[model samples]
Target chain A: MLEGLLVDLVPYGKAFQDLDHRWMNSEASFWSSGGERHFMSEAMVAARHAQWAEERERTGGGSGVGFGVQTKDGKPLGYFGINWLAPAHRLAMLGAKIGEPEYWGGGYGTDALLLLLDYTFDWLDVRKAWLMTTSMNARVMRQMEKVGFRLEVRQRQSALADGVWYDWLAYGLLRDEWAGRATLVEQLGLRERAAALGSGAK
Target chain B: MIEGTLVDLVPFEDDFATYLETWMNEEAWFRAHLWERREPHTEHDVKKFIERMEKDERGALIGFQAKSGDPIGALIFDHEWPRVRKAEARFFAGDSRYEGCDEVLDALLMLVRYCFETRNLHRLDAVALPFDEAKLDHLRRAGFVHEGTLRRHIRWDGDYVDMEMFGLLESEWPGYAAKVAELGLQPSGLEPKPKPEKKDEKKDGTG
Candidate 1:
């Protein structure tokens, strides 16, 4: 498990799987799916999990890796991970979501992202990490910029949400450009939580 | 077959599989045309790929035949998501002689027409490696706008290279078509009709 100031990245077990339908069908879906509407049944979520397991087994866990996000006290919040990893290029695409609305803007997502980035750059040794989001996802745009990710591409009118078109934005961060988890915690004002979590936090 | 002034977009046939065998083995061409890592493909592998492409409903693989009846290259339209009315376009000239030539431009224009007009797709996306200037120029000339660059997107010979992304929307086609007509690059059959002298006479009489 990867530790963070306010949350821990742990195996996405059955508990998280049970929550998939609710999270995927809620407003949280828009953030993760780039504004595409999704209606995932429990059975569909199970099938998706089976597919992910088969893929992970076939690729020996190299193609993609994901984890559930939970508070240090064991309360589930959301999940995030490397959506795709290309070892040949040492690059990976990262995705995350704070499924619980109450946790929104509380820095839980940021701490989870920092943990994922730490795992990606330090553990996986990826040279670059990137992601794609729509311009309508203001939270993600601010989160990406705050984490020092550069806005690399903006495909105009590429996505539609609520009958309006939005630009598809791609953000990239190099391994060398990452400020490390500790620095980010301090920069993002999560240091108070880090202190409460004790010495090895952040 | 979609016929153009300089080339015809023909359907893929067993004969085209041989070109794939050769092109897939050409390291430089393969690197420039595709994003995946390079691996040697046998004749059987190439045949399997052709059969799959033939049966695939998601997209199309079209061959380019020059006016002289020689297979010069191929145009690929794949990654099609019909629900969203979008697809990706890629092409390569197996015959080096036709690379960056006017015939290639003719082929591209035909592709654009087919995608936006015939297929009625909403958008077409394209990508080019950093070293592929001819393709970059061709995409721009064919009405695709440079959307953004994916930094260190592909690995090339122990180094990483950027890939430039381009997009063309259906609404933008008329402007590009006008530009093509203004530049006299449209095929003879598709060219804008010349103004009639009778119309000029009628206007003069009205005045």
Candidate 2:
């Protein structure tokens, strides 16, 4: 399991299926509003996990790494992952969700992002990370901006949601920016870790 | 083979793998354009590559000189989204001799037509390094509009580089037909002529 201040990143398996199913059937739609929402089944989630396992093997440990975000008491709250990874280039794409509506607006999502970004830049050795979200996702946009992601571009009228067209916004953050977020990096002790990694420290 | 003006896209064969390896690793502009390390590939690696291409739904075609049948490059339609009917097109002119020629455009035209007409795709898109001005201009002439730059999207030569994205919808193809005609971008031997040549020339009536 991956450690974090507010949550732990646990492996995905059959045990988490119930909460994952509920998440997908309900709260997940608001996040991926551009796509047609449908009922998700355990079989589909199992197949996706199997695919991720194959991808990890294919990329030789350089591809997607998925995890279930859990609380200190071992309650699964949501999911997070890094995909489309190019280890040689030190780049990857990131995505995450805190599916439980009661958990929304709490610090869990932000903590998950911090931990994931730290893992991406530090452990994965990825130098840059990026993601795309719909223009209507103001909550996610504001949170990402706080973590130093810049609004790079807006793909106009790229998505159709509820019979309306919306733009897709692309955001990116460099390792330097993450390291320079100052308070968060210091609070997470990532600054010292980064310095040590630079000087070949563990 | 998918025929074009100067080139034909032949189905990729196992024997062509080594040649492709050379082009990807030894070609002049390979490093500048491809955002990856130039690692040497063994025969086993080549075999794995061929197997993956054979199994992948994404189309991979080898560009060959229509007249001489010599391999020139590779054209790929990757990241296909069947639900959205969109795909990303990528090409590398391994044979540098055709860099500035219209052969690349001809090959692209053939591929674009196949995607829209044969494959029934709604959109075709591509990404280019910001430094690739010639390719950007070529895409523009082919009616692809600039979408936006992905800031620091790729790492090339130990530095971060931005990628400029371009897209073309099937609805826009007709407007680009005129440009294609003006450039005579067609199969090599099919260029339209103003008139047939006279068999005998009258040299000021002195012949």
Candidate 3:
């Protein structure tokens, strides 16, 4: 059994899970809308959205924060969310799924992961974050690093990918150890976010 | 819109909602790339990604914005892989009055200034699918060097798709900028070239 390479840690929404059910299996990826193996169905996407809603209430999180992804034309694509978030722990698990494989490796999976990391530490005051990936997902390992996750542990032959056991890679990061947060803030034009803070402020 | 002019790896987290917006941006990027590859990502997956990013700062993201008053399609200097200190110069009509994506590489020169000269970065690089002949040609026109291909690097449609990487060194950028400047807006349009003037029809018989 190998660790998962999913970009988000939260259970997927109906749309997202649909993506997961499709891409999680290598064979189903062929019927993807983008001619890529990474597309999901509607029923699968909603389930994850439910979890996201639950987590928001438990954490005083906002519903709009529930993340959504789509192409420029506004086509629903995949979904992501923060799971197992511990305010005191300053830690949260991130996860995402793209049913349309055409968009796989297109930078969204990794970029979306970084987006959440940006939110938790700066405004949310979290200290750090971590994630897990299967040894079979070398591409995912690279993607994890691209978003700045460092390997924390490697469970030897802990999981299976193709009837063979592979090591699972667990990666994490601290706020101070992070790079590009300030630039992203500036990039996002949110310097005045100070005025936007507070649960009821919005 | 505080467009991306300067960029660096950001460790600080973004607001939960803002992070969601960033995820939307990623979705757009993925779609653009998918169009090149002839596909798309999960439709709503990108927005979910933004929310997740709001939870932590494991992977620092870059910021991009266009300068105010700079033509919407004129000056688009954005960082792609800032670790490589590179930014993108986009020029798209987007189903509007505009027609093509020709000025993409040419617009990059101004951004190269912002990166190398203003930001004090060293080198810049860009990637293009070999199938995206238009984009690839623009890079070549902008004086970008064809570095090499990773070959079947990206998994697409149950298999891997070949990807080509191109690079433009800081040292090479200055001369290229000069070449483009000398031409002024003479080569403004990205449309395919018209037939050359024939020798018999030459106005000054210089041919």
Winning candidate number (lDDT): 1
Assess candidate 1 and give its TM-score to the true structure: 0.89
Candidates in order, interface RMSD in Å: 1.2, 2.3, 17.1
Of the two candidates 2 and 3, the one with more favorable DockQ, higher being better, is: 2
**Docking class for candidate 1:** acceptable
Predicted complex 3: DockQ: 0.02
The model with the greater TM-score, 1 or 2, is 1
Order of candidate numbers by DockQ, starting with the best? 1, 2, 3
TM-scores of the candidates in the order shown: 0.89, 0.77, 0.35
CA RMSD of each candidate after superposition: 11.6, 10.5, 22.8
Best by DockQ: 1
Question: For each candidate, what is the lDDT?
Answer: 0.80, 0.69, 0.47
Candidate 1 off by > 4 Å: A193-202, B27-33, B175-180, B183-207
Write one digit per residue (lDDT tens) for candidate 2, span B1-207.
776667777887633454666565654335334655667766566677667767788655545544456655667787676655777777766666665456777667777877887888878877777777667766876778888888777766677778887787777777334546766764333332223223245556643
Residues A1-202, candidate 2: write the lDDT tens digits.
Answer: 7776557778866656666667777756657544546577978866766776687788676457777898666778888878567777678888777777787765667767877887888787888888888887878888788788898876655565666656678889988777543367556554464454342211
Question: What's the distance in Å from true for residue A89, model 3?
Answer: 1.2
DockQ of each: 0.46, 0.34, 0.02
- Comparing 1 with 3 on DockQ, the higher-scoring candidate is 1
Q: What TM-score, to 2 decimals, does candidate 3 have? A: 0.35
